[model samples]
Every structure is written in structure tokens, then in C-alpha cells.
Target chain A: MRNIKLIIEYDGTRYFGWQKQPELRTIQEEIENAIKKITKEDVKLIGSGRTDRGVHARGQVANFHTNSRIPADKFKFALNSVLPFDISIKESTQVDESFHARYSAKGKQYRYLVYNSKTRSPLLRDYSYHVPYTLDLYKIREGAKFFIGTYDFRAFMSSKSCVEDTIRTIYNLEIIENGDLIELKVKGNGFLYNMVRIIVGTLIEVGCGKKKIQDIPKIIESKDRNEAGHTAQPQGLYLDKVFY
Target chain B: MRNIKLIIEYDGTRYFGWQKQPELRTIQEEIENAIKKITKEDVKLIGSGRTDRGVHARGQVANFHTNSRIPADKFKFALNSVLPFDISIKESTQVDESFHARYSAKGKQYRYLVYNSKTRSPLLRDYSYHVPYTLDLYKIREGAKFFIGTYDFRAFMSSKSCVEDTIRTIYNLEIIENGDLIELKVKGNGFLYNMVRIIVGTLIEVGCGKKKIQDIPKIIESKDRNEAGHTAQPQGLYLDKVFY
Candidate 1:
């Protein structure tokens, strides 16, 4: 069997999520069905991680083992032809048999978009979180710095998540402000469930004068989910890239 | 009675068009209905021009006459509270009764987006027209310059249009290339039906080696609709602004 890797991009607006459910529409099932149509095999495709409903992805990585003789590069075209317009195979390649989409991933990059304006944007409704309040950029920037470096990120994760290892190293976190759009680009070795959204929410709190910039360190030290700010909306979050 | 002016923005994906038709959902009708709900009066909303289905707008202009006691600026907030998520009244103010949305408009600016890439972009699916083939930007830029002048643009119009005067002045036609996206921004005193789309299509043909760059003047001089290229898709078109 040959191990094939695929890079995917999806709108996620119409999808339940990346994970496969019995009766729900999902990105995983759609691609798996498309793969079945092309290869006639019941392949279990492994994604780098699961994104919640309405969460988009630009470089979601996945892999599957197949016995088919189709060329590695050809899988992208073939799969894309049968997949829905909301999901697309960006690149496909044959990798070593030992390679796994989830296990072999070294790190991930995510971006969260905040539309800070007085009025709602019809064009950006599905792609950004609207914060109809003026945000202090200087405060948000200062607060974001505390999230970087190795720390127990349990406070930033969702309470529903039961992962034993909550300690994650954030490599970098950058805030880019362009007009009404505030983009948070984060790179981390691993993130707990809802970690990025929580971090974004915390930073937004600091920007809105709800939380102080100096409070981020204490929030992280608490290692309690309640100590952090609310989890931001799923629509604003995007899985940017999965590093191998 | 007060003559109120409105600057509107809409996604336009779910709207039939800007015009009101029986049993069909339109941007004009939606706003009119919202106005009726607020003032309990049937008001006719006059738009600068009609945008086709799926064609978006960043700054569309409109006006309506009303006898309601609501403040001009407060109408934006009041109507927005009852309007759908896909439509927004950006700004509203009292204007002179002599001002008309369509007749008083001096010029308009439009933008067309072409996503030049091999694979389709799911995120940009509703926003841009995807051109799979690689286009020669230099040729496109050279061909676009010919459109920046007064001319009888009959050949660039749709056959369904029955306008007597086909002459119009193009103030500027700019081609902005950024990564895999090509944006064509055009300002004109007036445009015939499908003029901007045809111009974009013709320029794209020139970029793809289908039409010659020097042949633009001849195509314009032909004054025949058949002499022009195909009309581009509505999704890629945006009514950027209406100047009075």
C-alpha cells in the first residue's frame, strides 16, 4: 500500500465540520466519498485535526493508504473533480508508508479575523467575527505577547475538552490590523480544543478594556478555562497551515 | 416630507437583483418592505442602477421620499434592525428634493475580480471569477488602456439592451494585479447593459492570446455586439461606488 498525502482547502460554511458523522454533512465524508468514486476503495482518510462547524481552512493536511496505481499528483485533480465546490484538493503527493497526517504533523498555524466596525458587513458575515466596538490596538498587541512561549494553556482551551496534556508551546503570535479587520496569526506546536479562539477572545477583551493587558500572565498561570475570556465564534477562525 | 439619501452595501448572493418583481426577492423590495414596516407607509426606493443577481455592492446609492418623523441618520439604524443580514444601509441623510438616485448620478465606478489559478478557491467562490489558465498580465494591462476614453461602446453592450445612445466617456480603466487575483477598476460617465463585463472579457481574451492587444480599437470601432468577447459572470462584478 502507498501512503498518499493531500492538502485541502474548504469554505466550511455548508459543512458540519472536518470530522465524519453518521448522518451529517462533513468535509471528511465528502472527500472520502469522492475518493471512493475514483479508487473504489473504502479508504479511511486521516486529517491533521478537526475544525468545528463553520471554521474554514486554507492548508488542511490529510493522508490515506491506498492500493490504487493512480499517480500521486493525479489524485488532486481526480478528487477535486468529484468533490463539492466548497472543498478542493490543493496538492497530493505520495509519501513514505510511515507518514501519518495527524501524527507526523509538527506544528500548525491559525488566523482569526475580527471585523471591528460600528455596522455589520454583509460581505464579511460568514468570514469574520463582528465586534461593533472600537478596539485599542496597542492594548491588544501588548496582551498578545504573554501568550507566546511554553506554558500550560489549559486556561485557553474549551472546558469540554478532556486532553490530559494541556501544556503547549506557542511559537509566535502576531496581530495585523488592516482597516476594520484585525487578524491574529498564531503558530504553535500544538493547540488544545478552542485554544486559538480563547486566546483571540482574551486579546479582544484587553482591547475593549474588559480585561487588562497585565492579566494574561495570571490567566495562563491559573490553568482554568473560566479564568480566560469567552471562545470566539467559529466563523472567524481558520486553520491556515499544518506544518510537517 | 423629507427626501432621504442612502448609501447601501449588500452581498447580493441571495437577492434576485436590485429591482422589485412580483414574488421574487430583491434588494430594492427588501429595503422598501423594511421602510414600510418602520413608517407604515408605502415608499418607492429609487436606486442609482440595478445590479444583476449575485453581483455585490460596496457603495450603492439610493433615495426615498417619506413623511415619517424619524431623523434622517436614525433611519439607518432603524431599518438595519429589521433588515436581513445580507443587506445593510451604510449611511442615510436628508437630501434636497431635486436630487434623484438614478437621474442625478454623474458617474459610477465598478470593479471586477478574476482569480487566476489552477485550482478553484472555495473561500473566493462567491466573490471572484476563477480563470484556470495563466493570463499574460502585461498584455491585459496594455489592452485595458484603450478603454480609457470617450467612445461609442455599442459593441461592448448586451444585445438585450435597447438604449439609443451608446456613446459614453470612460474616465479611467485600471488593471491591478495582486498575486493570483486580477482586479479591473473602471470609472465611467455611463455604461450600457453588460459593458463592463464585456470589456473585462475582451481584455481577458487579449491576456490569454485569444485576442490581440492592438485589436481593441478595431473592436470598439466595429460598433457590433458580436465583435466583443463573452460577458463575464455576475459574481465577479461589484458596484464600487456611485458618484453624484
Candidate 2:
């Protein structure tokens, strides 16, 4: 059997998410069905992580085992020919037997777009969160510094998630502003469910003077779900890259 | 009656062009319906120009005369409250009584996006033209210069157009290359039907070695539509700005 690694990109506007459900359309199920059509075998695809519905991905990584004689690089062309226009295979290569898509991943990077303008932009409606109020970037930047180190990020996660190991390390967080668009790029070793969105939501509160710049540490230390701000919309989030 | 001017933006993916047809969904018709809902008057809207199906606009200008008592700037907020998410009124103001959207325009600027890569991008599928061939930027730049002056651009237009005065003045043409995306920004006093698309297609042929760099002037002098390359797809074209 060959262990095939794939890098994929997708527009998640119409998808339920990266995971497969019985009746809903998903990215993983579509690719797995395509693989079955090409290889004539049932293969379980392991994704690096899960993205909520309407969340996009630029470099999602996945791996699956197959008993086919097709060349690794040619799988991209074959898969892309069958996949829908909203999904594309960027690369496909063979890996060693021990390679695992989820376990072997070291870190991940996420990008969020915020459209901070008085008037909503039709072109950016599907890909960005529209915030029609004045924001204090200085306050937002100051508050973001608290999320750069290792800590218990239980408050930043969704209350529905019950993962026991809530300690994670964040390497870097950057806030970039261009015209009416504010972009947030974050890199971390691992993330809890809804972690990045909650962080962005907290920063937005700080920017709008709803929360104090000095309160981020307290919110993280509390480890209480109610201590954090609301979760940002899923459409503005993108799974940018996964490190192996 | 008050003459009102509006600067609008739209994501034209679902629209059947800017003009109104009896049974088709168009930007003009949608805006006209929204206007009637607010002012309860049947008024005619004059657009700066017509954008073909699937083409977008960032700063399309239009004007109309109305007997409503709504303030000029307040119309933007009122119209946006009732309009669909795919169209937006960026600005609205009262203009001089003699102002006409189509007749008073002096020049226009357009932008085109070309995605040049081995793999198709799912994120840019609706807004960019995908070209899987390697292009030489130097050759494209050289070929674009021939279009920077006044000329009879009959060959660059669609064969169905019957405009007698085929002469137009091009102020500037720029080709910007960034990674796998090539951007073309052109400003001109006027353009014939399908002129920009044909020009882009011809320049692409030159970049890919399908057409020679030295044959641009002769192609223009021929004044034959077949002498030029194919018309580029409408999805990659954007009406960027309108000058008055």
C-alpha cells in the first residue's frame, strides 16, 4: 500500500465542513468518493484538523492509504479533473508508511479578514467579517500580545468542546491593516475548537473599547468560557497552512 | 426634481449584466425596484456604461431624477437597508440638474486579473481567468505599449458591434505581475465593444509565443476582428473607476 499525502484548497461557502456527515456535503467525503472512484477501494482520509461550516482552506493537508499503481504526482491532476470547482488538489506525493496526516503535524497558521468600513462591500461579503465601527488599532495590537505565549486557552474555545488537554503554545500573532481591511494572521502549535475566532472576537472588543487592553491575561487565566468575547463568524476564517 | 448621483459596487457573479431586461435579473432593475420601494416613484436611472454578464464593478457611477424628499446622502443608507447583499450603494449625493451619468463621463479605468499557474485556484475561479501556460512578461509589456496612444481600434472589437467611429485614445496601460497572478490596468477615454478583452487576449498570445511582439501595429492597422486574438472571458474584467 502506498501512503499518499495531499494538499488541498477549497472555497467552503457551500460545504458543511471538512468532516463527513451522512446527509450533508463535506470536503472530506467528496475527496474520499473521488479516491474510491479512481482506486476502487474504500480509503479513510485523515485530515490535519476540522474546520467549521463556511470556513475556507488554502493548504489543508490529508493522507490516505491506497493499493493503486498510479504515480503520486499524477494524482493531483486526476483528482482535480473530477472534483468540483469549489475544491482543488494542489499537490499529491507519496510518503513513508509511518506518515500520519494528523499526528505528524507540528503546527498550523490561520488568517482572518475583517472589513472595517462604514459601508459593506459586496465583493468581500463572503470572505470577510464586516465591522462598521471605528477601531483603535493600538489597543487591539496591545491586547493581542497577551496571546503569544504558552497558556491554558480554555476560555478561547467553544463551550461544546470537551478536550481535557487545553494547554497550547502560540508562536506569533500579527495584525495587518490595509485601507479598509484588517487582517489577522496567527501561528500556533495547536488550537482548541473555535480558538482563533474567539481570539479575534476578543481583539475586536478591545479595538472597539468594549474591553480593556489589560484584561486579556485575566481572561486567559480565568479559563472560563464566559470570560472571553463572542466567537467570530466562520466565513472570515481560513486554514492557511499546516506544518509537517 | 432633484438630480442624484450614486457610486456603486457589486459582485456580478449572479447578475445578467447592468442593463435591465423584462425577465432578467440585472443590477439596474434591482436598484430601480429598491428605489421604487423607498420613494414610490417610477424614475429612470442612467448608468455610465454597461458591464457585460459576470463582470464586476468597484466604482460604477449612475444618476437619476426623483421627486422624493429624502436627503442626498441619506439615500445611500436607505437603499442599502433594502437592497440585496450582492449590490451596495457606496455613495449618494445630489448633483447639478444638468449632470448625466452616461454623457458627462470623461474617461474610465478597468482592471483584469489573470491567474497563471499549473493548478487551477478554487478561490479565484469566479473572479480570475486561469491560464496554465508559461508567459514571458517582457514580451507582454512590449506588446501592451502599442495600445498606449490614439488609434482606430476596429480590430479589437467584437464583430457584431456596428459603431462607425472606431477611434479611441488609451491613456495608460500597465501590466503588474505578482507570483502566479498577472494584473492589467488600463485607462482610456473610450472603448469599443469587447475591446479590452480582445486586447488582453492578444497580449497573452504574445506572452505565450503564439503571436509575435512586432505585429501589434499591423493588427491594429488591418482593422479586422479576425486579425486580433480571441476575447478574454468576462469574469476577469472589472469596471474599476469612472472619471468625470
Index of the highest-DockQ prediction: 2
Fnat for every candidate: 0.73, 0.76
DockQ of each: 0.80, 0.81
- Give lDDT tens digits, candidate 2, residues A1-244: 9999999999999999999999999999999999988888899999999999999999999999998999999999998998999999989999999989899999999999999988999988989899999999999889999999999999999999999999999999999999989999999999999999999999999999999988999999999989999898998999999998
- Candidate 2: where is the Cα deviation over 4 Å? none
Show the colliding residue pairs in model 1: none
Q: Tell me the spans in candidate 1 whose CA falls farther than 4 Å from its real position.
A: none
Give the least accurate 10-residue stretch of model 1 chain A, judged by summed lDDT: A117-126
Candidate 2: how large is its RMSD?
A: 1.4
Give candidate 2's iRMS in Å, 1 decimal. 0.8
Model 2 chain B: ten consecutive residues of lowest lDDT: B117-126
Candidate 1 per-residue lDDT, tens place, A1-244, comes to 9999999999988999999999999999999999999999999999999999999999999999999999999999999899999999989999999999999999999999999988888999999999998899999999999999999998988999889999999999999999989999999999999999999999999999999999999999999889899899999999999998
Error of 1 at A239 (Å): 1.2
